[model samples]
Target chain A: MEEVASKVLSTKPTLFSYFRSSASWRVRLVLALKGIEFTYQAVNITKDGGAQQYSEDYAKMNPMNRVPALFIDGKCLGESIAIIEYLEETRPDTRKVFPSDPYLRAKARQLTEIINSGIQPLQNLEVLNKIEDELKGDRKEWAQHFIKKGMNAFEEIIKETRGKYCIGDEVSIADVCLIPQCFAAERFGVDLATFPNIKEIRDSLTGLPEFIAGDLKSQPDYVA
Target chain B: MEEVASKVLSTKPTLFSYFRSSASWRVRLVLALKGIEFTYQAVNITKDGGAQQYSEDYAKMNPMNRVPALFIDGKCLGESIAIIEYLEETRPDTRKVFPSDPYLRAKARQLTEIINSGIQPLQNLEVLNKIEDELKGDRKEWAQHFIKKGMNAFEEIIKETRGKYCIGDEVSIADVCLIPQCFAAERFGVDLATFPNIKEIRDSLTGLPEFIAGDLKSQPDYVA
Candidate 1:
């Protein structure tokens, strides 16, 4: 069963991904939440001398040259938030990723963007690489600073909105975004204890089957 | 009429914004497109010994401490994308920002995120200040690099998706996102002539009153 699950492929819905790319993981979490099956095509972002995402072929798939571009519904889509929202819209019958109320839905998106734009971009491979190249600053330190700042903001907002998750009792798109960032924070050596609400939210969501399915350890290309 | 319009305030969906914050401009674009009247309250991101957004008072309104927090629907919503999405959902009677077609809607959002997450966050005042402080790198050059790279990707996608606007004949959230980034690109000395599709999109959108109302010069606090 492990072998079958690990090597599953054949173009049902293809996800071009790097196993630990949190952006990619966010999409995977949504797919798992929706009970969707997909072919995992690893695009080893850190391998091959210069990040394979920069290749002409990958650029054609996503001109942005980033990962977790889901080739579903007869078209390829990029941007994890957009792809997640698309999945929510198209596969509403399974489990809804967004809340039904318009305000709650917007709040969910706000929390998602806080991580998406606020934290993830600041610490991602590209930006960290840029910092390392341009300033020769401590890349890990840079990542830690921004992650801590963003997490502080996330903690502040979640204090008001969380209820076993980022929005309420239900797991919204915000929770879908939260788990990956919390993983990123820990990987970057951030003390999650400083962010009690976020840590609490992370603790609650990590045990779920959907989130577990998309975690770093579960991916086909994961390396210890 | 000019006097009334310029000082329009007193409990009509307040917007806490900086004139030059592109993120803030995005929400303003949507409001103008929808013809929604909003009371503009400028939060000088560069004033009063630092950004007013960092004040204890303002942080209560927005934990993220960023500009363009909109007070509407009897609640204060931060994160420009969240506020805009909220406006779109509640005020569907106005000029629709997202398309009815699911794929196109996703595409529009994809383009929005490409700017929202990809470009804007990379070049915003906070990130630039970080770059300047840590590396002493030419901040303009840093901004230009990311802006050009993102615009390159945007141009590529729009080449396939362009009509009269980013997705098709009608305007979209993509177009809302496009105009501000174009403004930022030019500010950072990125020659838009290279990205003809984006340039054309910008040219077409800039002529509309909606885009103009949200532009840098249109705000109450324009300095130059």
Candidate 2:
């Protein structure tokens, strides 16, 4: 089934992505959930002396020099949230990733923004590199401090708004954001048990076929 | 006309805010644009020895312990983005701050998120305070560096997507975000002339009645 999905997706639109990138993981989950076929064009950001920076072609596709650029119907869109939303709008026949009620949609978007803004940038590879190179701090300790702070905030946010999903009983864009952040948190040894709400949401999300298939460990380039 | 709008709005809701906060400024712009009346319940975050730390009542409304919490129709919403979006949804008849097309809407939101997540947090008071007290840096220099970096990125983003507005010819949520951030940038003396697109948008936005009313100088607590 996994092979078939990959093959079919490969024949459709293509996503230029890195397997380990949380932003790319978000777009992948949306594609899987929507059941939309799309090709995964892997650009290993870590290899060949940083593929994203060295590739002239990729830079043209995304001037911001970020991963998870999508090429659909010959037009390219950068920024993971923008790409996901484009997919959501273009393929409305698939499951709706955003809620219908404007207020609820805003709530869902707010949750996604919190993770995107509050947590991800703080622990991004570039920022961590700065801490190690310029600040002269133990990389592990700095990463641990931010990851813990972010997760604590995530726990509070989840407790306030979650139900069967991040906003309520429905899986919206918020869930797509939650999973990857959780993956990053666990890698930093932040202890998922401390955030029961986040753990429960992660558990529920992992059980879904879409999420399971989108897992970094399940990707073609999975190292470990 | 401005007085009447303010009077009508003042009767509709109450906002818990800090005078110098960009997040608070974002909500204030939304309220003014929507023509909603509200009272400003000032929480001088820095006055008389850190008032926000002692405001347990405010914490109940927002577990995140952030400012610009809105109480509307007896319901409280935290997060400035969340509150502005809620107002847009609940009062769609007033004025539509979000675009109807999903792609455009997503693009506008992407700009908003980039500022909210990518730029704002890097220059936030809390983060700057941490850098000063804990990292032992010149607070003024550190603030200027981060604010300039964030604004430069923002200028590039605006140049790419902007039309008559941040996303297009219409004023959307992105403008609400842009105004406050520009104000913050000016406060840090980052030289707006360096960013022509941002300068143009700022010029256009300041001419509008709603934005003018939301200006920090026009607020009830304006020092000048």
The candidate maximizing DockQ is: 1
lDDT of each: 0.86, 0.74
lDDT of 1 by residue, A1-118 (tens): 1222234334578888888899999889988988999988888888875467887767877899898788887788999999988988888688998989887888888888989999
Q: Residue B167 lDDT in model 1?
A: 89
Model 2, residue pairs in steric clash: A9-A38, B9-B36, B9-B37, B9-B38, B10-B37, B10-B38
- State the displacement of the C-alpha of residue A162, model 1, in Å, after optimal TM-score superposition: 1.2
- Stretches of candidate 2 off by over 4 Å are A1-11, A47-59, A101-103, A139-146, B1-11, B48-54, B138-153
User: Of the native A-B interface contacts, what share survives in model 2?
Assistant: 0.40
Which prediction has the highest lDDT against the true structure? 1
Q: Model 2: C-alpha RMSD to truth? A: 5.2
**Candidate 2 C-alpha lDDT tens digits along A140-185:** 6766766676566557766867898887888889899989998888
- Candidate 2's DockQ: 0.37
Poorly placed runs, candidate 1 (over 4 Å):
A1-11, B1-11
Q: In terms of TM-score, which candidate is strongest?
A: 1
